[model samples]
Target chain A: DAGITQSPRHKVTETGTPVTLRCHQTENHRYMYWYRQDPGHGLRLIHYSYGVKDTDKGEVSDGYSVSRSKTEDFLLTLESATSSQTSVYFCAISGSGDGLGFGYTFGSGTRLTVV
Target chain B: AQSVAQPEDQVNVAEGNPLTVKCTYSVSGNPYLFWYVQYPNRGLQFLLKYITGDNLVKGSYGFEAEFNKSQTSFHLKKPSALVSDSALYFCAVREKDTGRRALTFGSGTRLQVQP
Candidate 1:
């Protein structure tokens, strides 16, 4: 096991409301990433953090923001949730920046529904 | 930009028969390939990866993938299909020395093993 945990395995909220998803890892991985899985799109990167307080946006990052305050915690927030933002959010951690002897470990994922 | 492609949206096979899920990728430089499996309502589980080695790579749950550099394909295969192997499979790729560490995932292919 990679010691990764994601909170709120399922959630439902009204449109325009804000929602936050948390990803915690027991392993001290240097890189943390947030991805959303949608039908026909596989998993698209939303945001990722290479280190504490350092982050970058991804292809589908328009409706989301992310923060990493500690080595173990990465937080993903949707400022105003929309029906289109309803997706299964996953967290993945890697030991290195590149794929040099490193592979990603994914979390259980948070299923968000915007009603 | 690097990208992965899964040509088939679904693959059906009978139990005890061999199975294959095709994946192709486009990236500059040598590619780092990976495969993941996802059951319903679950997070993605790492299957196997090929960085630089012999063509065949074996992973958990009796899964193996062959990396064909010339064809730019990494196809997942199993000697015998199991009903339990029915799940969504994803292929991902990251190019070496691309300055981007994130993986580009292909659209998933659903695998159904009928008894």
Candidate 2:
């Protein structure tokens, strides 16, 4: 509802293949985040971008990489897909600072399966 | 480190009955607590947040959460449950001391509202 869209709503790929997911936002927020949701682990942050070309890793960023070359787009890439990497990926954007305190706005989500 | 816990994996409630989903948090400094809901095949949606205010915070879809400092808990509640209320709920926490604004999420709780 916050003008966010995730490409490839659903994707199925074989193991060891590379894959990339895209998140586009029209809100022009200052922060973008990539997260993976799996059973027993709710959701874990993979990476986040506070600005263009400024990215940081999260607790579970080992097999994932992210790029934010533009304000409206953020990309998440899996170098070599594994069965364990199969999960629902979500992209979220939020404003900066503690002013609004509003939570992040999430995209519809991308469901990926590595078979 | 900041962490949140949703003790129950699932909760069942009949239509029109009051419902609650438990959440507890651990943080180094003051905590910023939030609640989110996810429907099948959709991304997480923000429900409410407790930054620094009254203990009771109201959110969307007739949902509210009570923040208890002594207990370090923020439990989500609804006056009456509806079938549409059935979904997965997540609790998140952020620590004031940490400059990293990333949120830590709980394992999630599945709510089932039966008619």
Candidate 3:
């Protein structure tokens, strides 16, 4: 409960539609991350932001983009949704050097279904 | 490339018994190891981490892990298992030398505690 909140806890959309997921944190942490969880595959990083406007692609960033215009908010968008993009998305926050000493806190998560 | 492996896909234990989940990692420099738990439809929750210090690190929910440098292993352990402890566990690793502080996670192991 790091004062983190994710919008649209659950959603179902059609293929080719665009969708955006929001992750808001009150801790003001410097690092924000987007990850997707799926059965058998575990959690995979999609994108992350180290600072405002400083974003980078992750292992599974093919269809996802992230934005961090403010310290407290990180947004993840699917430019064009595909059925393969359906999964539970999570936002996590952490500070440099803490290295889990402070531990990374994750939002409740958003379940998206692409039909 | 930094990566982690959870050799076992699943583990079963009875209540009041001890449990162990094996995790091994590979990284260029000293590794930052982490354990996270996910339940049902929720997000990942940090269990513990091993940074720089004693080999044994204690974490939430009475869980602890030992960092074996020679073996490149960080196995999660608990003295007594509880039904509530059943969940999907993931092992993660990051290189200390890399300025890019993103974690590489293992496939995850499901733990089932029998009452």
Candidate 4:
């Protein structure tokens, strides 16, 4: 409950369609991230942002993209939806990524399905 | 690269019993470890973290983790397990060696508390 929110708690989309998941944080945190959780696989990082307009890929970033045009919003986009891409996506925010002080606060999560 | 391992897929405990969720990590530098809990249809809640200082780190919801530098493990423990404590638990780590601040997560272990 660190003032984080993820939209479309549940969604179903067809293959090849584009989908976007939004993560909004009330707190003005400096770091935001997108992660996907699937069976047999722990939470894998999809992408992350350190600051406004700053973004980088995670290990599983192949099929996803992220944007941070504003400080409060981090968006994850699936350019062409695939069945394999269906999973529970989570958004996390942190005041400091250095881990010297604070840990990440996560949103409820968005459950996506690609048919 | 830093990595986390949660060997157990599921852990069952009786009410009022002590519970332990094991987590092992690998990192080049001093690791910054963390534990998070996810309830049904809810986001992940930060339980605790270990950056430095005493090996025994206490956190929210009566949870504590011991950072064993020798064994490279940070196991979460609770004196009493509650039915309400049933949920998915995750172990994560961030290494000072990597440029990216995103955490590497384990597969997750489900804690089932029986009444």
Listed per candidate, the RMSD to the true structure in angstroms reads 1.8, 1.5, 1.5, 1.9
Model 2, position B85: C-alpha lDDT score: 97
Tens-digit lDDT string for candidate 4 (A1-115): 5588999899999999999999999988999999999977989999999999999999999878888999999999999999999999999888854343556888889999999
Q: Roughly what TM-score does model 1 have, to 2 decimal places?
A: 0.96
Q: After aligning candidate 4 to the native by TM-score, how far in Å is the CA of A21 from where it should be?
A: 1.0
Ranking by DockQ: 2, 4, 3, 1
TM-score of each: 0.96, 0.96, 0.95, 0.95
* TM-score on B-chain, cand. 3: 0.99
CAPRI band for model 3: medium
Stretches of candidate 3 above 4 Å error? A96-99
Off by over 4 Å in 1: A96-100
How good is the docking of model 2, by CAPRI class? medium
| Per-residue lDDT of model 1, residues A1-28, tens digit only | 3589999899999999999999999888
Error of 4 at B52 (Å): 0.7
Give the runs in model 4 whose Cα sits over 4 Å from its true position. A97-100, B97-99
**lDDT of candidate 3?**
0.90
Residue B24 lDDT (model 2):
96
Clashing pairs in 2: none
Winning candidate number (DockQ):
2
- TM-score of the B chain in each candidate versus the native B chain: 0.98, 0.98, 0.99, 0.96
